[model samples]
Target chain A: MAALSWLEWNPTSFNINNPWTWSPGSDKKVCFVTTGATAPFTALIESVLKPSSIEALRNQGYTHLLIQYGTAKDVFSSCAGAAQCNTRKDSRREALTIDGIDFFPEGLKTQFKLVQQSKGLVISHAGSGSILEALRYQVPLLVVPNTGLLDNHQEELAVAMERSNYLVRGDVKDLAPAIQKSEDFKDKMTQFPPITSGGHRETKSFADIMDETMGFLD
Target chain B: MPSPPPLSALYSLSFLLALLTTLLVAASLRLLAILPTTHTSAPLAAARRKHPHATRLLIVLGSGGHTHEMLYLLRALDPAKYTHRTYVVGAGDAFSAQRAVEFEREVEGRERERARARGDGDGDGDIEKRKPKTEMETETQAQRDQPTPPRTLRTGPEAYNIATIPRARHIHQPLLTTPLTALSTLLYSFPPLLSSPPLLPAQPPQTPYEAAAADLPDLILTNGPATGVLVVLAALVLKFFDVRGAQSRGMCKTVYVESFARVRTLSLSGRCLVWVVDRFVVQWEELEGRGGRAEFWGVLV
Candidate 1:
């Protein structure tokens, strides 16, 4: 196979007017929240838990409300039935919920793309990963730790990020205000380096990585 | 008949037990279905490359994170070689679909302009190639009025197909239902590969080399998310049937990439799929060989 050029944007496969260039803090377009891999997110699936919290967020003017739920994916397989409780019938906006609680929001691409495309706010558990990803994208964030989890370490991570003023840490009980405060943090996200899953060297270009991966095929 | 324990009832009971044993024996014998198709990692991949046709790659785009990482890998893939590609996500994962649509739109936009440029550059050749297929497909679908869009250069065959399969498990579902849900997911992910022949496209290419787009998945690439597990499993099951042609020639090769998030451990899907997947690549060097069949492939996010 010939070496494939990642930069060879054959015009046929490239989008000319990329929408991801939206200015930061432009709008609370998408409020993306996740509780990590396990689902149902404690009170999230049961009793239509936190309907008011979601409402508070909606009231905060997020048009595309994308929330990732844990454990309780079946209940809201489609966004139309998210929260089991009636999501307000607003023709103007949409609420999309994905079950990735145990690995939920697992829509790795869209989540990032959404973050990139709009002033999407990320509300997630305070895992270093969740925090780093949101920050790397320069999205404003809110971190809520699940103390019920085996790792109480997220508490420390949240506290530190909170101290940095990079994000707001909130309890489920106070989700609305926390989301509102995320505005204060979005500007601070530029302070950190882009999250690097690879080692400290210069980041590998898509071309180089493509060659190496395709080499495995050869 | 109830007056005494009928001797005939005892005989009938024994007969039922004997029939049950026979069924169990036959079921065990059917396990032999797996032997013919099972493949070792290295040879299977070798066999795939050995084939002349363009490789078909089914990339299972797990929700959110997996979708992003997989797209990165997908963009890196050689479209010239992997002619036919399927981007599948879990059922009800509109977000994954939304992302895929976004990617496809970009690709389509790119195609639209390139087709125009190609029309300007090699107008006659482009039209001559697309004319027959467009006409035939339009006739087949009975849409004569719609002008044929300039076909994306098949580089090999059909460009891309996107699909969705049911998820293995839902949040907070009962444990007893898990087995059934998983089976349905497996059913959804594959099975079609069994029914459909290699998809060569509308044009009757003179050679399989020209027919690259018409192939079934020669390779399956998955990162994580439970839905991916079904795709990998479906490949294995399809291979077991060795369902004729290139598929029977060998099973589809699968490459399971551990998410970049896993510095020390594998994700659940990664862990579950590791043993079965043909080539398991990890981002963190430290995880190399930590899980059997996995290798460190440097950072690939």
Candidate 2:
């Protein structure tokens, strides 16, 4: 139930329900961050919007920072001002357009697509739904698990996915290192839903197992 | 007479206790006999002659992550093989139910396109029949170019039904009252497990989907959610009593797939039903042979 609530959360962001309204320019590189919607990870919003993390993105040629802040609007706004100020002080290039959304209510498909098209990076909370969606776009993903969660499944999954080279794992306290690593991770990441999983052993797809269990030989 | 009985060893309280213990042990043995073991179950299923007819597949959709992975695992679902589908969702979970409808529509759309391609007379019927791109690549081009033999098409709204049951335990519910709510959910699961209503009652089953709806599901597929565990329990009760010859007829065969999110350990629901389910599957290699017999078939989703 907590998982499904992401779709029903109220649209409290300044941007309208249509995400395309505040579109980034075609040439701008976007770095998208999605915290959990039902139980908003305020710490993630704070960390990603930290001055050092924003500086890391700017150093990597990023032009936009879009955060799906969930219910942490106050945290987003508080750090967003300082982050923008820091970017403005060094004006060699265009300022990073910083924005926040409480939730999409539908999905983050448009955001993922935008990141894919821009050759940008996606930093998401280590929820399987977001990880699976982000990986489908074949874009570089940095998954940060909330250490505050009672169960450590988020950390366990993030570590395992990283071991398989599917995504990079980030610490909630410091995301700059992981953000910097995303640039090199794109080419080395494994194609997800792997074609040849389980090594030399015969690997059957889910459909094959269904047919086998039913004894449908054909 | 009462005084005499008090002194007799034959009428002692210890003897009565022993009788009760023996009965309890016997009941447990019977229960274990009915539960399927992986080694014996698969071979028995494979030994059976192929039906090649109407088959009903029941799928349990959990909230969020489970539903997402369940749909991906079923991406190559062949409607022509499993003719009818029954999707079980928790009450108030409109998202999962809506996703089920959307999935069916996608199946219907694909089938329509497949039929149209066959009608175009381009000799691409076999190509259209194949679903997975990886599997298609392995077959010779000549084999794929051959015309596919016509089969019954099972797609659209009437071919499937979405059954919703109340949540077994609401979030933050008091632990003391969980059993009562879970029991109610178990009771509600019986109707869908028994048999789905035929598409049209007056007429005999004309389509494979209609025939399947009138019969018990041949398979119950779950991805180890709370609601799914209870549904499997209800099916186990049916098997225990051989209701409607469910056990003898091989209906309600349970398969529990551990979520892909669980790389090393099983989820709570998976831990509960691992031994009970006929086929327990885990995605990660580290989890293989868990619960004595969990299967690993690569990353399914």
Candidate 3:
């Protein structure tokens, strides 16, 4: 009945650098983290999750931090500047740098081990692909819908996920409360079914028009 | 001749007079039928008065009789909003474009006078008179005094500077004259000949707009489906009647207002209207949907 069992159905390991990465920790609590150039999640993580707020949560004995860095553009370039600033600020949360690995690679057993050692939390931009990955791993998600791009699509997705009781939708203005409620949020993630479509149905539906227009016209 | 005041002659005279009166009535009705009844005369005159200085306006001429309606609409527009830089394309004689150029020249002259008045600071000497050694004047002097250097001068017309003449240049070229459409020029020029009184006179065509308004059709044909039908009908009628001087009139303009109206009406999923109240944000999806529609019809701020 547990949502974590769904990960076994599709046993595809994920690349750590991807916006979605989840693994079982030593405490057996699933943790995942996402950081991409997507405005909503990035804004939620960087702007909303203030260092002071993170430290306050850290004081409550939360140790692991799964950080997703720039999936929207070139990850290294986008996050390198911000990573330097975070280091200068001496933020309390540990930064796990993941870049380049899109999906789970062959020789990443040690990385999984490290992930299992810390009972970290998963954070993700409201990309349906990333959300599906997180759900497959049965990792509780802290969803930050990117309002800047995708217009209202991400907001709709995030609200739907929250309603399904699979994730907690974090507001940009108050990410601390969402983070503090992460334990309760993990309890809530168990209720929803795994996402089946992966957000390609609408695009597939529109693809038929392409063949009729372009193939015939060209 | 020995004239007799007979009853038969008197009866014939009265009958002829009655027939003449009926003929006059029929002729008037025919004239009225041919003339467009949708004449916004007062509105057009008001628009012209309001924008008397507007000599240039952007025009989109399509293939139908829409151009006629467009001109009517243009005339309806407060002329002050446009400089009347009119460009007519599609299927009509080049008369309107020619006339537009003349109108532009007149409007430009008026504009120059207005500009001169504004530039003449506080009733002082004219700005042109004040700026003695202007760039143009210096260039003119240099050109006038400079010797013609004989080394490989360009074979085309020589450039000259004349301060007395206006600096503005108004150029008009047939749209169909381009290399791609040059072959079709003959076909395009055929429509004007069939329309009521040729739109322009056969003199050194001094721009079509310079031709008397009475000579031009009341409408301008645009490139649209409906107007295209009208043009075909008018052409056929003219040919059947062997009429030489009539022209069709209709004009049209495409605007972006329709798209705005569409957005307001369609409220699909994944969209909710959000409103800000003081510092708090509230999401009222239903109200937002309705508001979006309302905003379309509301006057643009």
Q: Best by TM-score, which number?
A: 2
Worst 10 residues of 1 chain B by lDDT: B43-52
lDDT per residue for candidate 1 within A31-133, as digits (tens), equals 6666665333544333223566667666666655554554445543544255433554555555533222223222345565676577667777766556666
Task: Write the candidate numbers in order of decreasing DockQ.
Answer: 2, 1, 3
lDDT by residue (tens digit), candidate 1, B1-301: 4588767875797878998999888655644543323333232324223222354556778766678777765554445445566678777777677777677666555555565434443344664555556656566356435464323354322466667678888867898998899999988876534422334445475545334434456667788878788777877766655655534555366677787656666777887876666667776666777554566544555
Give residue B52's lDDT in candidate 1 (0 to 100): 27
lDDT of 2 by residue, B189-289 (tens): 99999888767667788865677787788989999779999999999999888898778888888888999889989889999998898888898889998
DockQ of each: 0.06, 0.58, 0.01
Question: Of the candidates numbered 1 and 3, which has the greater TM-score value?
Answer: 1
How does each model score on TM-score?
0.51, 0.87, 0.28
- Full ranking by lDDT: 2, 1, 3
Query: How many clashing residue pairs are found in candidate 1?
Result: 35
TM-score of 1: 0.51
Fraction of native A-B contacts kept, per candidate: 0.03, 0.62, 0.00
Instruction: Give every prediction's interface RMSD.
Output: 6.7, 2.0, 22.0
